[model samples]
Target: MTSIVSVRDLKKSYAGGFEALSGVNLEIEKGEILALLGPNGAGKTTLISTICGISIPTSGTVRVGGHDVVTDFRAARNLIGLVPQEINLEPFETVMNTVRFSRGLFGKPRNDALIDQILKDLSLHDKRDSKIMMLSGGMKRRVLIAKALSHEPSILFLDEPTAGVDVELRKDMWDVVAKLKASGVTIILTTHYIEEAEAIADRVGIISKGSILLVEKKEDLMQRMGKKRLRIELSTPISELPQELADRGLEIAADGNALIHDYDTRSDRTGITALLKDLQNAGLKMTDLETQQSSLEDIFVDLVRETS
Candidate 1:
């Protein structure tokens, strides 16, 4: 697939000698949803801003749909729509007017039919005539999305789109995203919600301290860094693991009711058979066994901590 957005050796530094983005390199393919995950002030927004032409990069290059963000700003920016983290809509403007004006600002010809479709798709059609101030927070957020889609940009940047929204609203927004993807829109979102990314993103990127820690296909990343634990529920509570099994990295639960063993799934030998045999030899009986896999949140926290 051809890349719609590309970054190479991207660097950004402030006058105070603080780096917001450090040697960042990334590529977003056409028609893919890529989620950028990071802690507060981890450079996710900075990178997005540079790509969208809202902020200039101190160094490096960003291209959107074959147009250079710096040299061909107009062409690059025209192909993208950005829904910022803050809701900065005109308080007095009606939803319909706001969306229509956004399209006009992009020099698009008047198209009421297209505007109506955008509002309806975002579930804002009912609120089209309502003033921005009269709409609830969730409705306002939907208007923001409607406005971003007004000009029919190929790439959409959603910065914390579901932040502060209720559960129902969040689910609604996810559905909106799914419909947009089905229509062939490329989405790049920055979110603190790990599960949201885990549920929606085709690929996930972890950023920390102004650098991208890792970017991989969601399932592949999980399979590679994710670990599984075998929990053996002993029939007889053991105070301590026997010396014979001390070589194995076994953790005794604080309650002393179960034994937890961590093993690499990628390994050829899990040693489960040997461990069970050794447990029986040590006079330990397991009543039941269960395995738990690490989630995306687990891998994210560990990666950030490792970089820190």
Candidate 2:
């Protein structure tokens, strides 16, 4: 697959000398869903803005579909659509007209059939004639998506697409995104919800302090960084680990009724077999045992903390 959007040494600096993005490099594959995970002020939006030609880069280069964002702004931007974080729709304008105006602004030929399908896909067909101010927040959000898709962009940027929405509505938006991915639209979304990335993204990128910390396939990231903990619930409480189990580096739980062991999932030898053998040799009675896998949120928080 070819790269639909490419960034090389991308940098963005403000008047006050604050760098929003520093020496960033990335390649977005065609028809893939990439999720940008970061905390506030982590430069997620700045990166997206630069790639979409919404913000001019201080230095370095970005190309969308082989066109430089700076020198070939029109060609690069024409293939992209952005649903920004803010709700900036015309309050008094009807939904249908609003989407149609967006299409016309892009110099696209009037195609009511395309607009109709976009509205229907977003469940906004019935609300097409309603004023933006009269619709609920979720409906307004769907309108934004409809407007963005009106021009038939190949690359779509959804920044905080589900922010400030209820759980049901968020899931609804996820379904919409899934359908878009099915239609072969390359998507780059910045989301605060870890589950959102875990649930839909093909690959995940973590950024902090104007730098990209890591980018990996979602399943690969989880398998490599995802740690598992074995909790040995003992029938009898013990104050200290037996001398024979000292080499295991096990820790006693706060309640003193169980033992905890952390292990890497990627290792061929997880040491669980050895630990169990040691426990039996030490004559320790285990009432029950369970394992827990670390979530993407855990990995993200740890990465940011280390970088900070």
Candidate 3:
């Protein structure tokens, strides 16, 4: 599997001496979906802008499909498409003209059939004759996607594609992304929706304070950094935990109906058997017991906090 995009020691600094990115390195494989996760001001957007040649880097190198982003910008940019966070389409332009014009910008020959396929694939065929100003917010967002795909680039960058949209629209967008993946298009997306990444991304990258914290396979990251919580419903209400059980790091619920214990899944011993035995010895009766694995959002928060 060869990388379609690569970055090395990428850095960006403003005139005010603020660094947006510092020595960032990443590789996006051909035809793979990679999700970039970070808090606001964490430099996720800055990194993507540099890779797509929208913003110049202060230092470092970025290559798209073997073409250097700086030295070979035209060739590199022609192979990639970007859907920015903001919707800035021409208000008076019809949907079909907008998409067709985008293709012409890339020097692609006029092909109504290809443009029609893109419009249909994005569910914007019915709105082809509608003006951009006449469409709703979700419809406008779909137009942006159709325009981006007009050039038929190998790589696509989606920046918060589903922000502020309704649940139904978001799900529809995900379905479109699935079809794009099936067509062998590599996608790199920046999102605040952790669940979306967990549901769609093949790999996850965490960035914080202008640096990439870690990148790993979704399953591997979850298995290695994810924790398991054992929740026990208490039969008897207790104001506080007993001294004998205080060493186990158990947390009593505010409602006084449950006890929560967290244990690392990768640990050699989860101590569940010992903990259960001790609870019985202490005369604590459990009505029910259940375990929950930590979500990607939990792991992301922990990692960012640790680095910050």
Which candidate number has the best lDDT?
2
lDDT, model 1, position 307? 90
Q: How close is candidate 2 to the true structure, as a TM-score?
A: 0.87
lDDT of each: 0.91, 0.93, 0.92
- TM-score of every candidate relative to the true structure: 0.85, 0.87, 0.84
Better of 1 and 2 by TM-score: 2
Using TM-score, give the best candidate's number.
2
Compute the lDDT for candidate 2.
0.93
Q: What's the alpha carbon RMSD for model 1?
A: 4.4
Q: Give the Å shift of residue 289 in candidate 1.
A: 6.8
Q: Is candidate 2 or candidate 3 better by lDDT?
A: 2
lDDT of 2 by residue, 49-141 (tens): 999888899999999999999999999989999999999899999999999999998899999999999999889999989999999998998
lDDT of 1 by residue, 214-304 (tens): 9899889767556789999998788888999999899998889999999988779999999999999988888999998888888899999
Q: Model 1: number of clashes?
A: 0
lDDT of 3 by residue, 78-176 (tens): 989899889989999999999999999999999999999999988889999999999999999999999889999899999989989999999999998
Find the number of clashing residue pairs for candidate 3.
0
Clashing pairs in model 2, backbone N/Cα/C closer than 3 A: none
